[model samples]
Target: MKHIFIVSLALLSLCAVAQQKPNNEVSLDALTTETQFSSDSPDLVEFIWWIPNEFWEASFSQDPSISASEAQEIVSLVEDYTIVIALKGKIGVFGGINYEDVDHIQKEFTVTYNGTDLRLIGEKELNADTRNFISMMKPMISNMLGPMGENMNFFIYDNKKSPINVFEEGYIQFTLGDYETGTELPLGSLLQEKQCSVTKKLHNGKWSYCPYHGVPLTNK
Candidate 1:
């Protein structure tokens, strides 16, 4: 009788564990719906953008606290603002307030590649309220859009045409691209100007390329 009870308990524990396991599945449409808030406030609004499964798995393994729901929400939001240029490509740009003080700023932006299960093509941060940071982001955004446009045979919207002033905050832009096999790469993969590369594969098998030079990047 005791053996039977033990066996039942073990099975129940296994079932519970399986139920508690995180389900990483997410949807793009759920992420882009308009939230009740506006971009003018300096709050850490969740921006769930689409990313590749490999990237998502790697990121979740590193930081398990990142919720799958958050990822889905961000992707949906990005998709809503995205401009589809072709059958397989699109570009999404959106921005909201992060934090603003007298001398510092902090903001986040993301780009997605829909070819392979929500791959992240670009992400940027504007910090320290410096003109250099803004200037840096402009090229970075361009780099993210350039390769997508070239390989997918579409043109990206120029952010310079619709400039944003964040007072002490920053803005974000997201771009998407079609799936191209072989060596055809995105702007993040090639040089923009003067030995500057946009994306690089890290030693850890993750691509975090430099925004200025398309080489493996490291956080400075």
Candidate 2:
């Protein structure tokens, strides 16, 4: 717990050093709704979600203490991977999540993009540059999450071979352990409005796929 707070404070200090923005330009709640997507499964006792670069960009962009250049530099460092964090606890229960469970889930995670299932790699498996990059940003993620960040472990999917344009894809799928019907994050729809590629049908930005044609929606 002491280590967590220390790391979080370090991140806050870094943010303070950046250029300031106007007051209350954007709220964390608003950003969470757009960036974080949760699963609807009632059987699982844990709360897990995927955080894309879009969230970090918007977070830094709207933060009063962070500069645009600093934000871009930080985001660009990990632009080639997929990030997901998980904690063992019920949603809306602000208490600490199990620390032991973090290690367990870190080893058992999967990410699916464009119907291709990919295994998630733990932090130790990452290259030195990427590892260093995550070390700086992980604390910021924990700081922003507050209690939810307690005992949380991050899992990464190396998509460099087949990069994922999260803003262009319909949705990204995440699963931990044997939990089927994993969380599907409608990242593209949340980041920007999309339209059907074939029919040019306009969706209300609620879904990433066309209802009729059953295909991924394209950015509008």
Candidate 3:
């Protein structure tokens, strides 16, 4: 009877431990939707994001309290960040955004097939050009929609949403020809002008650095 009792106690302990473990299957929509924007704020975009455990441990940048196996919620500090990286290198442009218009200033915007919901960001209407661009990016975004993957990165939306950024190297081998030879892509040009903070990957599997800011060109 003692042996049976011991075995039963062991099984109960195991069950309790299993139940205490946090769910690895985090809800993407819930995490992303928590980001928000307000008209009364100083800036139109908000810098909020869900940080993974690896990021903390990789640099050990934070205190010992943050561990590799533990995920951090509600991270808002971002530098040199933009929505262009979410394009998956499909196209080189940022048509749906207007830099001068703070509201249009994209804070890590990613392509999505879902209908445009500006209300989430305190906006009543979206620019037509932006709408069309979002439409074009639907398929590309859908191609990589799901839980976090090996090559996927995350972007915070105006501090109100979270979107996965997929890194598909060489996804588009080449373009047939340049549609506009002389005219530069508006977003591409702005990126060069140091107006936006979209990080570019180097050949060494590392991110580029900003000389002026003297920091790594990446979103935090």
RMSD of each: 21.3, 16.1, 20.8
For model 3, residues 1-220, the per-residue Cα lDDT tens digits are 9999999777644322211112232233332332211122232212223232222223232446655444222112221112222211121254232222222324323323122221122222434443454345445544544321212223322423532221211111111111101111111111111211434432111123455554434322
Q: Estimate the overall C-alpha local distance difference test score of candidate 3.
A: 0.28
Candidate 2 ranges with C-alpha deviation above 4 Å: 1-31, 34-44, 89-99, 122-129, 181-220
Q: Highest lDDT: give the candidate number.
A: 2
Which residue pairs collide in model 2, if any? 21-64
lDDT (Cα, tens digit) per residue for candidate 2, span 29-70: 644655454456453455565666666776777777888888
Measured with C-alpha atoms, the lDDT of residue 220 in candidate 3 is 22
In Å, residue 58's CA in model 3 sits off its true spot by: 2.9
Q: All candidates' TM-scores?
A: 0.19, 0.60, 0.19
Residue 124, candidate 3: Cα error in Å is 14
Model 1 alpha-carbon drift over 4 Å, by segment: 19-25, 29-220
Query: lDDT tens string, model 1, 22-48?
Result: 223322222122111112213232222
Best candidate (score: TM-score): 2
* Candidate 3: regions farther than 4 A off: 1-62, 72-101, 106-220
